[model samples]
Target: MKQYEYKFSFLPEAINDCEKVSDLETTCEVKGKYPCPCCCYNTFPVPKEDAIAYICPVCFWENDVFTSSDDEPSDENRGMTLNEGRRNYKILGACSQDMLIHVREPKSDEFPK
Candidate 1:
């Protein structure tokens, strides 16, 4: 699993050497913002390293630090794997069928180009 520090800063100077993404596919380097693993939307406030869990507002997948692999089931996520969450998001518009009511559609600016 990858580790990331949570930071909150709008100033460009706040970005430092620690905020570097080695893999765009699975990590976010930007300060105070992180890509939701389930939705791929840059909306998470806390990075994967910070234990304060965040559920994506768009897809409703709870951020769990350990389950970075798409195939691995996460206890923190109610035993749902990243792949299952992604598939559920496509079909139900949320990370799980039951989460449809808990999630909202991504804003126009939230989708990755």
Candidate 2:
């Protein structure tokens, strides 16, 4: 698998207010610019009440759901298999204390490679 590094940021005030920094709720203001692990495609992040799951832009399947092992498929994973080619689908990443604010181009001064 290829490794992709991206920068993430969080407001100090937001971090301080949350009981658990990793559980902070996020609202994707951009609407449709989330990261896509497969083929490095750019798309919207999957939204959830408390968290988001990282999804493939082209495949429209959650990363976890897409990468699930074949032997132990759960109900959720089973559902994902059905919509592997839908458009406008998204997936959220694992919850973390650090929330990503910007995704800049490589070699840019704001986000150096």
Candidate 1 Cα misplacement greater than 4 A, ranges: 1-32
Residue pair clashes in candidate 2 = 8-100, 34-43, 52-92, 53-91, 53-92, 54-91, 54-92, 54-93, 55-91
- Considering every candidate listed, which one attains the maximal lDDT? 1
Model 1 accuracy (lDDT, Cα): 0.76
Model 2 agreement with the true structure over 1-113: per-residue lDDT tens digits? 99999656663434455454352365333334434433234444442222245533233344444334434332533433323322212232211112112222222221212
lDDT tens digits, residues 1-113, model 1? 99999776865664466655566466532332667888888777666567357778888888788766879888878999989999888888899888888777776667776
Per-model TM-score on C-alpha atoms: 0.64, 0.23
TM-score of 1: 0.64
What's the distance in Å from true for residue 31, model 1?
Answer: 12
Overall lDDT per candidate, in order of appearance: 0.76, 0.34
How far is each candidate from the true structure, as Cα RMSD in Å? 15.7, 19.0
Most accurate candidate by TM-score: 1
